[model samples]
Target: MKILVCVKRVIDYNVKVRVKADQSDVDLTNVKMALNPFCEIAVEEAVRLKEQGKADEVVVVSIGPKAVQEQLRTALALGADRAIQIETEAAPEALNTAKLLAKVVEQEQPGLVLMGKQSIDSDNNQTGQMLAALIGAPQATFAYSLELDAEQVVVTREVDGGLKTLALKLPAVVTTDLRLNEPRYVKLPDIMKAKKKPLAVETPDGLGVALKQHQTVLKVEAPGQRQAGIRVDSVDALLDKLKNEAKVI
Candidate 1:
């Protein structure tokens, strides 16, 4: 069986985000970029399934500009057999991305589709469900653990309070959460080997997916700066300030 893993390129989690001066969006002129952490976990899980002899191949896919090929290479280094890039000038929102992926799913017909529960940049947490809905597949979101059987897969998911388990038939969608297996480091040798792996590029138009904007961003701004704290000389002083100045007594 073939497993398809979806990954995304985003600003490295370590980098401090800076808002643009015009309030259009975050400034990303020359910031460090890396694969989404949760997507890395999804790639690791797909590779692990292949390594365990449960899958015949693990294919990694990403949708973005040419830079996304870098993240796809990293996924290949981590153990994906091949990579596909859905080339686009700008990244699509969750719904259009799902439409593109649904087209790919129709062509590939993989036994399973795995992706991050949400991208760090957007945090929409809707792509997986949208893809599943588009393709008429069962879905398990926020999955931390999975058990594969001949006919179905049981997934343990992180919910609001505790955990929830679900069994999904083959050709289903699974969105991974943080508590899933940790991603392995990519050694220099593996990175070198990944360079030799096959990477294919396609486009939304090529996939016959009509990209349309359903929403518009009015503005983007950073949060207000927090006020500095001060220490009072005594409880009386503190109480007086709270009552008179802050007026929260």
Candidate 2:
């Protein structure tokens, strides 16, 4: 089986995100970029399947400017057999991205598709489902545990109540959750090896995907500073505060 994994480049989780001075979008000037953590987990899972002899190859793909190649290489270093970059001036919104991926899916025709539940930067959590919808493929989202057989994949996913399990046949899409598996650290030698891995670049136009803008960002703002709590003398005082000052009642 050939697994195709979608990855993204985003600001490192350790770095503090800043809203642009003009409130247009997140400020990404000179920030350290890394693979999306959830996407990393997806890559790890795909690589693990290949390592276990269940999968014959793992191909990683990303969409964005040339800079996204950095994250593609990182995925290669982590064990993806090859990488494909769908070059765009900027990352498209979720649906457009799904369209591009759907085209790639048609071209590659992999047995399974994997990606993060959401990109940390956008937190949209919509791509996987959209891709599945576009391609008319069975989908399992927020999967933390997965088992594969000759024709179907069993996925255990987290739900608000607890967990839900589903069986999806081959040629399906699965979005991974954090608990799926811990990603392995990349060594220097692997990083060096990744440089030589085949990295192909294609444009959205080349894929016959005409990008469309479906939404516009009105503004981007940092979250408000949290207010400090004050001590209450008793339950009565808390109740009074809730009823009046805090206005809960």
Candidate 3:
């Protein structure tokens, strides 16, 4: 089986965020970047399948600026066979991103496509599903575990209260969740090898997809600061405040 894992470059979760002075976007100067956390799980799972001899090849793909080649190289270090990058100055909206990926899917034609449930920077979980629609493939989102039979796939997904299962034929899309397998770090030897591995760059128009936007961000504001609560002298005072002042039972 051939597998294609869709990954993304995102701002490092640890870095402090600042809104641009013009209020158009986030300030990215001197900010750190990395792979999306959930996409890392998908990469790890693909590597495992390749190691088990269950998969023939695993390809990593991403859509972002040229700097994102580093993220794809990171996945190659972790064990993907090759990578392709769709170059853009900045990442676009979810629908446009999906349109870019659908072109890659059409070109590669891998039996399986794995991606993250959402990207931390945008927190938009629509790309994978939208790509599936564009490519005319079945989609299973929030997958925690994946299993394969002769020609079918069984995906276990995380739901609100419990787990749910879905079965799909080959050439399907699966989006990963947090409970997926823990990702492994790249060893020193693999890092050097990954540098020499194959990586191709193409533009969105070169891939024959016109980026389209379906949503807009009016503005981004800082979250409200939490206020400290008053301290009560005794249990009776607390109860009195809850019942009369705060109006809670």
CA lDDT, every model vs. true structure: 0.94, 0.95, 0.90
Candidate order (lDDT): 2, 1, 3
Task: Give the range where candidate 3 is weakest over 10 consecutive residues by summed lDDT.
Answer: 214-223
lDDT for each residue of candidate 3 in 40-95, tens digit (9 for 90 to 100): 88999899988988888999999888899999999999999999999998888888
Query: Where does candidate 2 stray beyond 4 Å?
Result: 230-249
Off by over 4 Å in 1: 231-249
RMSD of 1: 2.4
- What range of 10 consecutive residues in model 2 has the weakest lDDT sum? 144-153
Instruction: Tell me the lDDT of model 1 at 136.
Output: 96
lDDT of 1 at 240: 96
TM-score for all predictions?
A: 0.93, 0.92, 0.93
Candidate 1: global Cα-lDDT?
0.94
Q: Rank the candidates by TM-score, best first.
A: 1, 3, 2
What is the per-residue lDDT of model 2 for residues 41-157, given as tens digits with 9 covering 90 to 100?
999999999999999999999999999999999999999999999999998999999999999999999999999999999999999999999999999999979998679999999
Off by over 4 Å in 3: 231-241
